[model samples]
Target: MKQHHVWTWPIAGYLFLGGLGAGMSIVCAVADLFFGKGELLGLAPLGALLCLCLGSGLLIFELGRPLQFWRVFSTQRAVLTFGAWMVILLVVFDALYFSFFSGWFPWSAAAGARAVVAVIALLLGLGVLLYTGIELSSMKARVLWNTPALPVLFALSGILTGVAGDYLVCGLWPYGGPAADAEALAGILRPLMAGLAVATVVSLLLYVLMMYTSSNPTGRTAATRWLRGSYALPFWLGAVAAGLVLPLLLLILGGMAAALGALLFIVGGVFLRFLTVYSDDRRELAGERERLLKLPHGDEPFLKSNWG
Candidate 1:
């Protein structure tokens, strides 16, 4: 079979930015709604709302036509179903985006709307993870993506990548409220970093475990792009060493070490996306082509390649 590489850069950006927006939105929601942290007042949840909206917008437009995106909600079923949840999230995200950009936020009445949307966005933000999980799970053709663990893996990857994206944005975040205080921001950042690092490791283990349990060629297929020399350098030295191993050790240390660890965690998360999409076997894609051109789905007989 001919092995080939396909780039998923735009979708990668969508996945990365969407996850980050959703993650940040959830964090802000938890901070604002439950703990009653007023520091979340201005741009905190707003930023998350905008980012998610922007990312989701990109995704809708990222498709063949932006209008076709509405096909997700044109259903006759009840609204609480998975499709409903998706549609709801899209609407809620859109509202948040429109309201903020239109300068509706500072008004006294906007507070109530913000409160409601924040809670709903939090729930849907979590759904973002499941949405991604279902995306891969629904695709039966790509066996590697067919595992029951795929949804969970995608969820963790989303959260991990999202948090990492948040940290990377720290370079741009202007100081204010909790973020203004260096020590306090460091404190908040450390725990988040540690949590994400732990999550990333767990995700890796689950992936391997899923593969180990599978006897089918579908489950056992390899995406060697990550294991090869060209990709291996950044993936291993940068993503693994700098992102996981080094940050983990520093997290063990404390102080500036913890902060540094957070940076590495973000770096690691970004590359994890790179590795996942690039290393794709897509379940022996040539086989799919053959099935399209030669054999039927259940047919076993096949023609030999001319190269052989």
Candidate 2:
């Protein structure tokens, strides 16, 4: 086994992106159901797909060996990973959604099927977020990653980031202002973006609590690094100040303020992922070192052999 540690960047960025994608997807889905459909949500539907596509591509990029990578998903898990069912479903969802926008389907189709689709999407989205969370929590080497709060934290971060992604789309395209049929998206941009702001605040509060309240030293120390140490600038300034705060302000004060806020949110979210991925990887390595050090060794072995 390699002594020291340096994980791939894809693991870091993609995990954060996956969680964010799931979170926002669900939020938009739910909001669309309860408060009526947000056409801006149409913009977000593709985030999970994009995140998954990019994430998978990044893993391939890191590996540079498609056959070896293909083999991992080719086993029993292939059905789950590369199965035609999931791909087909996502494609259908993507297609119908696009068709609605392109006038391929009647407006009646979007309004009619949206409620049911949102519910299903919300459940699946949460599942995706949870899977990312469980992966982190299950890593024995990274004691800091093995916390109860990981899934929720990841999911929340994903949601915040996902919203940022959607706003980015709106900012660049300006919804209906563009030649396309995104005019429907204009109405929901404000509220969908607002929901993203809400998710960010909620995620930040939860993270603060998760850090300080950890029962073990590994968990606490890891959180400390993220909240205060090496990762502090991105965590505080980028994640909180720019990502969360600025977006909230735009939400409260619309127009160019919201556009500016959206830009900040996307940049901030991207930077925040770096902080989280690096911090988590460090925590894992540190935890392993601490444990190995505690093992009986040299003269200490004899004395520590039997418990009194």
Candidate 3:
């Protein structure tokens, strides 16, 4: 079978970074709004900002004409354009929220203003997270990506990765902040990480199973590749074992094991993006394979000879 290379590593990187950053912002906002731990988890939003910026760079790099990226915003109707706006708005809000945490302004001390910023950041963050999945699922020609299950799975994975990132930075980093606050935050994140891990695993399994059993042969082929074909190793080892299961087990064990698990989860998140992106095979039309098979091979003598 011919391989599809339209979207590759750069796109995958954008997906991973975008989802992770958005996830981080969502977690931080929630902690701040309801739990009063937003200040304690300040590093998350900063990290989120860095992630979004890096993700946006990767996105631009993936474009044929990187300088023409502004064209994405020229039309307000396309999903990509909407996503671009989401990222921009997310960056703006997340930066403002981070500024408050960083104590850049005296007004940052105001709880009311901080809460409002957090709320906007949180909404925009969720929009970014959902956009990542919607972006792929919107591509109808790619049977493997044209499913509602995809957005749900991606959203779940995004949140799980975000929690893992938070646990690593706020919970594990020695210089993250006050030792007491770090310990407290770690305690809160531990169980949350485990729960998210379990949920992600379930969501992933359902997504793959749905694809494997889908009516579309192309979708099934993609799922088979992940399950037991060429992509199986990465799917099983990188995403399932290392990313979800190992992390869950380590989180249960507590101490340094949980930290390692958190890091593994992030790695797994990256693998997930690559696997999904690469598996996006377009649905084959009737006789498409036969038609291609009849085409002259590059090495054929007739083709090798110059027509002129």
Candidate 4:
């Protein structure tokens, strides 16, 4: 079957920004309790809000019409319904929690209320993070997205990005005050970055391997696209090399390198989502492609729409 209405750049932008927001929400919560008092506690929630708004806005933009956007909420499709609701809940929870941190609410001084809001926001944040992957993987039309590893891979990537974001905010913004506070935060973040980087690389490899070996020919095609097709350059250079490798190397050097590493990691994160959207848009059933290859007619159509 011919492909139409393919996912494009908007989808990629949504996935990247939404994943960053979700990851940041959780990181903010952890920083709130762990550090007790720091710039991150305030920055994380604010950053999350900005990311979520921009990400969600892109989703609406992808719908291509204002009137049709509301249908996303009423849709019977599990992916749409679940993702929309999760984003909604995340926004509500994070908004209230951040309001408390911002001291806009008089009851913000109450530890019990803060604790409850923070916990709920963190859970919703996680839901938002995982939903992005689940939504993509649920697309039966794309063999590459059907794997169970996609959700896990996205989650690990989100965690890595979230930590990187925190490191950047704390290092550059320095709300905690004094060089010593930054040093203390760095001590905590350095090893954490190392661990997350390792996990992200492993998950990425597993995702590629699983998709490559999938029984479906379409699945294999999807894998090939990522591995060696038109997407090869962006996948290798943008996502793998710049996104993963360089960040890990810089992070190992410690100090300001962490900020540089985080920035590079964020770039990688964006490119990774771009790879996902563009790669799947090119996916075609492998069996169908083989049949089309045997056509007695001109090879122009076959070559023009080559599955690979």
By lDDT, the best candidate is 3
For lDDT, candidate 1 versus 2, the one ahead is 2
RMSD of each: 7.0, 8.5, 2.9, 5.0
Candidate 3: regions farther than 4 A off: 171-178, 294-308
Candidate whose TM-score is highest:
3
Give per-model TM-scores: 0.69, 0.68, 0.92, 0.85
Off by over 4 Å in 2: 1-6, 31-41, 72-92, 104-120, 167-199, 202-209, 212-215, 281-308
How would you encode candidate 4's per-residue C-alpha lDDT over 1-308 as one tens digit per residue? 33444788888999988888898888878777666643544667778788888888888888869568777788586876888888877888878776776655788667778778888878888888999999888877676776688888888888788888877776344253576766787678778877988888888877877877877666677778788987788888888888888889998788677689888888888988888777674355457667755655666687779863
Output the lDDT of residue 256, model 1. 60
Return the clash pairs for model 1, or none. Answer: none
Q: After superposition, how far is residue 80 of candidate 4 from its true place, in Å?
A: 1.7
- The candidate 1 region of ten consecutive residues with least summed lDDT is 299-308
lDDT of each: 0.58, 0.60, 0.87, 0.78
Report, for all candidates in order, the number of backbone clashes. Answer: 0, 3, 0, 0
lDDT of 1 by residue, 145-247 (tens): 6667766766776666555444444424332444455344435656776676677677765674566456656455452333454566766676677767788
Cα-based lDDT at residue 282, candidate 3: 91
Candidate 1 vs candidate 3: which has greater TM-score? 3
Poorest stretch of ten by lDDT in candidate 2: 170-179
- The sequence of per-residue lDDT tens digits that candidate 2 reaches over residues 1-308 is 22333445776766665665665566567646775544545556665667656765665666657657656544464323532233334434543443443344556355667666666667666666677666666665575566666666666666666666665554232124343434344446667667756766676657755766777666677677767877677777888887778777876676567667766766666665566555553344446777777765576566777753
Model 4 local distance difference test score: 0.78
